[model samples]
Target: MTQSDFAAPSRYFVDESGTTGDLSRAGAGLDFKQQPVFALAAVGVDDEQGLADRLAQIRTRRFPQAAELKSSKGHATTTVVSELLDAIDALGGGILLEVMDKRFTLAATMINTLVMRPVSPDDHKPSALWFRMQLAEQLHDTAPVEVYDAFIQACRNPGEASLKAAFRAVLQLVPPETPRDSPAGAIRLFTLDSLKDYRKAGVSKPEVQRRFLPLPDLGHTGKEVWILPHLSAFTNLYARINKLRDGRLAEVHIVHDDQPYVAEILRSSKQAVEDLAADNKVMALARVDYRFVETGELTFTASTSSPGVQAADLIAGFAMRHTRDALAGSRPSLESLKVFHRLANTLDGAPGFGMNLMLSNRDVLRCGLLPSQVPPMQPS
Candidate 1:
């Protein structure tokens, strides 16, 4: 029953923090607020027995009565968290993490669906993506909060009426009274007109509608069509894993914590990535930073059965708490702060390979946490 009995596969254990429920409730005036941030953490390991043994030793000394390591338990204490970090470091493997702001995500989704659709010939240009990123951030930061609220409501029950309302909400944004030719005024006007055109052209047609709208996918019963944070983080992590092992002889597989509701979608999503990866030219033109490999499998298992998954849970929990507090402008205990710095030190060198903040540039600026604190945004 010991991990030492058999050689371990090249595996990365994964887990997440924060709820993935519908984000529209915050706007529905239902006294609901989803977790402001969502995060996924993956810890890669070449030695299962080494990780298992380290975890076992930690449990034996610090929490003899506990059956398993749960981040929610005392294992998140500064000392225990440090121990877990050390455990990961000892394995000489890499880490991948993703964090997002849910509100900013909704705003970005609305902009992508409404203003930037029908991929123009120019959209493939090198600067198009950067332009869009800036525009999305501007809209998210400056648009009336009602715009996002309405968009969220529409996504929950995407119909002609709701979609119309969402589109109209976007159109209501009035550009600042700046010089007519200024970048600020120009971009706003462009965004407004784009929304108008998209609405006039028919926002409900099948061609336009198939791109992740009509949320809470009734067809799949429990499935949702909106871009879930879990999917984005999961895919991003996979790319990083591939990058970590790009030229290596070993295969990389992921052992994820069981997520019954989203498991099927996760598999389908991975397959979809593989399909996309088949087109080398497209990926190259897009300047994708990583590639998907054919040698690995993504499978789900219970955390109770895998020490690696438990360790990931601990990492995820600490990240969630620390990030949530930092965003709220609250300080952590001295010990937690020390450990957080150490954690940041580990992430500093890896850039995108280690931890990533998926929030908009505007949100990043508003929070004022990244420049001197966390690692800078991944190199484009």
Candidate 2:
């Protein structure tokens, strides 16, 4: 083991709001539309026992009967959140929260798979990400219902056949009626043409075809494979942990709430980061955040057993509720907004380190968050 391994590593506890599920499922009851946002929060504490004691004290004072505290139980009121935030600050801990708009993420995923990814591994470039944001927005708005329906179906029964059908649907898209000369029409046409060309190239490359499809066992597992905002959010949070420390020598050990279904996938993702960090060729193209995470793997514990995870639950609940309200075009309460500002202040002005938002530009604009706090899109 390295010398740094002997040093006490910073510990973080993680919990998530908006359970990960296939967003394509639609019916009279639509979770994606109702929830709209997925949120993950991690709380780092230098003094675990102190944090735990504080949390226990808060519960005793607030809810004398409850065995455990949970935000999902409608217990993360403004007063409770304020106290939790205070305890976090008092214990020299910081919180990181990641929120994503499910619909916007779905649109971006399609563009990422069909448009941005290169046919050959060697042809990938950072510049390809420079302009896809606008295309994702255009595709999300102008796409035919058939296209979305097909993609949803593919997510349900993911395979080579389903992916091919969905990609073909995209390639053969006849955009909805719009004035040909109008700016909107021009964008739709441009998006359609771009997707057709890129997806065509993607389909022809047999070696990388599965990259365009879901995980081989997605249907059987019923786990979320496509449009994984939770995974993206967690990766960003992990990166933020390294960034906040500004040194790779200090190890980071995070204990996340036990998620049986996604545990293996998260470990695999961590291994990919470990592998990519060591590969000179890949690291040359990857961003700075990809490096400096010293921890080799994650540990999981139930929220009930971990104070840090419980603290994270409160923050995630606040973040999810406020963002959902903003997305639905409803004004948030002044108290809620105050707690948000307090949460924002915890980062000490580093934008993406404390809070990350993965919403479309339109959703962001209406979300009532400050312009400076919105995270700039990072290259994939």
Candidate 3:
């Protein structure tokens, strides 16, 4: 069937909260500290109007007064989220729920060591290294092998594991055929405070600076500095979300209590959506905020808006766009064209090739241009 003949994919709404230990200091506040639980939940809605109605019910249940609603309080917030999941499940939609018992400190540590820090040159070693150190400090008598095996297993299959193991156990609650592999229509929920704590504890500014800075003789005098911890936190979150999206979980809607933290994530999400859409030749139809029915809290939804393009279509368009652009405005010999074609075919595994081609100079040069062009067409 043609793309138009297919139904729009189902949508998943996701939100996260309660992962950090010191709630008092976190953006979500002291109440979250008491729970020290971090949760990521997803709920599927049939359509935009249905989503709005459900959110209204959640809002009425959680907050009678819109003015008094705050994003960080766990008690009412938890109830709203729990109720929303129940409603979605009752309606035969999918639900994913995961909760972590570790102190926010420990969870933060794990996120840092596992997800955030590995991309850094200094922390590029196996994830087991830091995990072992943390386990030794916490359990004392536990063997590293046990911890390593558990961690790897959890990462590979979050649906089977508890939030305590991988923080992704919520997926288990979802229906097995929930269409997680769809291009569009997956909703994701996230909490920013937990991510912030993890970033602050796991990464150091000096480390990033050291890696990015060039030696004096290299002629790069200024050091690349990132002062705001939120920058890296959101950046990491964006990467993680895209990873999920690439894996076929679309329609990600995040719920975060901390306004500032949520705001940053929104900003990053907006940029990501725009960049991805533009690079892929897809359009972002809409991003709007609505109240949660249970809590009377406001949440945001980002949608493709139009009926024409599926999420995968957008991705494909981006690839085609880049390929076209790469092939345009250049005169390459037959051999050079062959090399470009081979390189493009090999790198097809790369996500958002069109976007990557446009945004990344390296990919454009490598995939679009001939290798012989390097070093003034020096022979291989």
Candidate 4:
């Protein structure tokens, strides 16, 4: 057998930023918020040792004091991160990313989740009944209007239970080819919070028309059931990986920075992979074999322990800083955002699929870029 048959598969280094925006600081405009976006970034490489060594060289040279490297610092930090990015691309690694502008996440949804969470204050919070009543009132023109209205109000707050019910109410309105008998919580977690890449999830035109009501017409992206900003970023990255290399390798793996909420990440990713492998998701089938996700695995490591994970940390951190700058109307000069953008060219001789962006409608209209130029996944 050829060496290719036995060569170890590439390990994808993944990292994320802004999972929890400053909820206390959330206000009227996106610009003033401390955290305007959430980003998940990854780089794929076959030569794990080589890439790790190169990154160590840069770190040793730039941060000789054994000082920690952070992307939010000054020009010198940019130099370190930019060079590390260059090393990855030079070594034939592929990059993928997803960025979500969270300002578009509806206010009503965030309040609902906050109310349901365990640590919620015991008094003065709006009950689930009141929340549903408002949804029924506001979505009077949408498909769920009748369902929301007809559903009996709860005696008190539904807590986490409301999440499944809200998601179920929405999905039941759509005409499924087969009846959906699954539990509402299962349905919400499996589909809305799915981690499989969008490309692998088979969200093409045909499936969209088949699986969902006119959701966009309802004036929000199913926000009541899911907190989409960060989740979308993770899914988009997974999808992009499948898109670029469907048949080249036996498997793919991930090493990501440790996070407190790792369970959410792992759970969504597993479901995504499982859904892709299911018989009905045709576009997903085109992008990945069932074994790809079924057999694929991931491990989380602290960045200090794993250079690959550290590299991912720098990549995501640098990208998040750029986006935050963009929000505050602070322009990153040639030595900043420009360097990272240039590094991207080394991988595929283009901007590369390493970057995916989602922006609020306000930013979209203000940014001067055409809507067609931006990918459709970002919130409108």
Candidate 5:
């Protein structure tokens, strides 16, 4: 059963953090200080057994209770979290990371549906950035930042009423033309009507200043989340597929953390890639057709059986900490988040290879956590 006895395949171990299935409820259940970002992370290994050995060693020495490796403790202190991340980094495999900005997502999703404005020369599906830019243009330049700052401050260790009032304020800034059944619409209507209600009352109390939308109560709880770890894997693999093809090695086994619904997402992703491969889809990054994926069998196994998955969990914590800090308006420090700025397996000296920052410019600004080495947004 020793790792030295067997050769490992080219595979990725993936895990996720900050997932609240329903997008709107991202931070709905967690305490207000918690991050609302969703991130899926993967650690790719050419030698899986090495990673397993390292993890086993880390657990026995650093994580006494975790030696059994049942499940991640959901949160680890900076020291424990760093030890795990360092172990993964020492393995030398490239890391793949993806972050989802919920605030931007919430606003963007609503604006896309509610606003009828068309782009120049054509009517196409509005992009998240486009929606934000549109709203930013309408604002007094400082409104978005002021509103964003208010929400950030309000959500910090917020109580139920605080959340209601805070989100109601958020709704006011993006209210739709007419009230609708959707939460986005409701928040929008509330966001707008609350302003009206407050103005009519002619009160400037702190409560009135909150611009809260009235709801039945403030103590509702929990929501679901979908973390398509495979999507991160897809991006990771796509970046390397051309190289794999060039090397005449088109096979890769995916190793993922034993999360719910993972197999289905992987299978679905596999099929989609297969279909695209069958059609000879070209990847712009590699400037080659997806022949690599077509020729390869992307067989994946759950992480309960693989040590690589545990290493990927290290990345989950790294992401969790960075996300929380990023939300609080600070970047991850190398002393605290050693792996936050580390870039391995890069292409053309890019800050990330399989690693991707999923947040938009607007949210990044809100968090005040832009790293010096972060890559510029790719031209889509």
Candidate 6:
């Protein structure tokens, strides 16, 4: 198969963060630097909703009570791997999973290099920006090689445009000297500022901060890749649905998971999502569901007797809870997106403040939120 072979459908980008356990708490007493495993993955889909719904059906045992599906585990640290896998399977897509190796200290080092470090005097830039670009390139490069090769091989011929876009997205990151007008350049510029702003706002360090740069924008972009091929199909379906007078052409569907930190990641990543949405000019839609996988009230032995049932029940209950919460009220609607300058004084102390600030603002614009809308808050 070659890039010249197949016709592209509406495409989509799909991704997954975390897995089935509470790895965020893996560092209970250890140095903040030491943490267990967490994973983030991105996949391209031809039919996002259909894929999501199909996966939900397969995992129906996992979410019995969700009024509507949502794809987050409403906590500060955990990844819902099962739900993520279901999503991948349902969408008929391939994945690029980023797993933190237990033996590698790279995760922590990378975080410090990107997030904890205030500014980079050496480059007169924020380390975060550099780190984000590097990370995005790495993931983009490795993932397609490891997983998408099969997809590529399976295709009799793939669309040249998509293949070129995907290849360009990855290639732009490597060689380090690639021109700045590429996707790699965009990622680097976007991430640096995002981290800087996050710190300025005094947002508490996320569990993964010490081990990962937390480039939510990259994750969102990955999802876009999964969705792009299927855009035309979705648009047509949406148009027909509108003719029926059901409601908005856009539909928000969620994939439910039972990981606690998934929700927090989703929340924290909200800024990144908004950034990607704007950069890509697409309506962003996502939600995360988190709940306890264990029944503290029941004895371990009793719970073990019906592990499947217990897990399913817990997930369902949590989904309903979240649905109710979303119905209760709305968050501020995203009216517009823009980038602005941060007072140099506001950025003074941060080591890589300048670079970080610039990238963050860019990401905000990319995600479809106005940088000016983010109020300044001091770092914790």
**Structural similarity to truth (TM-score) of each candidate:** 0.81, 0.80, 0.31, 0.58, 0.56, 0.26
Expressed as tens digits, the lDDT of each residue in 1-380 for candidate 5 is 12223222356666767654433233433332355666666666677777777767666776677643433564344555556656655555556566655554433332322222223323332343343344433332223544544443343323444444544555566545644664345445534554465556544455543333211111114222222223433444444443433524456565666554444555555566557656756333332234444344445556677777666666665666566676667765556544454422222222223345545555544444352233222211
Q: What local distance difference test score does each model get?
A: 0.63, 0.66, 0.31, 0.48, 0.47, 0.29
Q: Please list all clashing residue pairs in model 5, or write none if there are none.
A: 20-224, 20-225, 21-224, 21-225, 22-224, 171-191, 172-191, 175-188, 329-367
Backbone clashes under 3 angstroms, per model: 0, 0, 36, 1, 9, 63
Query: Tens-digit lDDT track for model 1 on 1-380?
Result: 12223222368899998755545555343222536787788877778789999988988888889987788775766777788778877676556677767666665556556555425546534565455556566676677777776677667666677766776676567546755465446455765676566566677764444442433422136545555667766766666565545523146678999987677777876776666666542222221233454646889999999888888888888877776776667756777767756654454544334466667654444433353332212211
Model 6 lDDT on a 0 to 1 scale = 0.29
**Which prediction has more favorable TM-score, 1 or 6?**
1
Identify the superior model by lDDT, candidate 2 or candidate 6: 2
Q: Rank the candidates by TM-score, best first.
A: 1, 2, 4, 5, 3, 6
* 197-262: candidate 6 lDDT, tens digit per residue: 544644344432322221221123232111111121122222222222222213322222233333
User: By descending lDDT, how would the candidates be arranged?
Assistant: 2, 1, 4, 5, 3, 6
Shift of residue 101 alpha carbon in model 4, Å: 1.0
Name the regions of candidate 3 deviating beyond 4 angstroms.
1-10, 14-33, 48-86, 90-92, 101-258, 269-380
Say which prediction, candidate 1 or candidate 2, comes out ahead on TM-score.
1
**Against the true structure, whose TM-score is highest?**
1
lDDT of 2 by residue, 225-316 (tens): 55456666776676666555653634668889988777766776666666665663332222225564465348899887888888889889
Model 2 spans with C-alpha error above 4 angstroms:
1-9, 24-33, 118-130, 141-145, 155-208, 214-224, 247-250, 281-288, 371-380
Write the residue-wise lDDT of candidate 3 on 62-152 in tens digits: 6766432223422233344345434543454432222222222232333343323334333423343333233222321222333333333
RMSD after CA superposition, every candidate: 5.4, 5.4, 22.5, 14.0, 11.7, 21.9
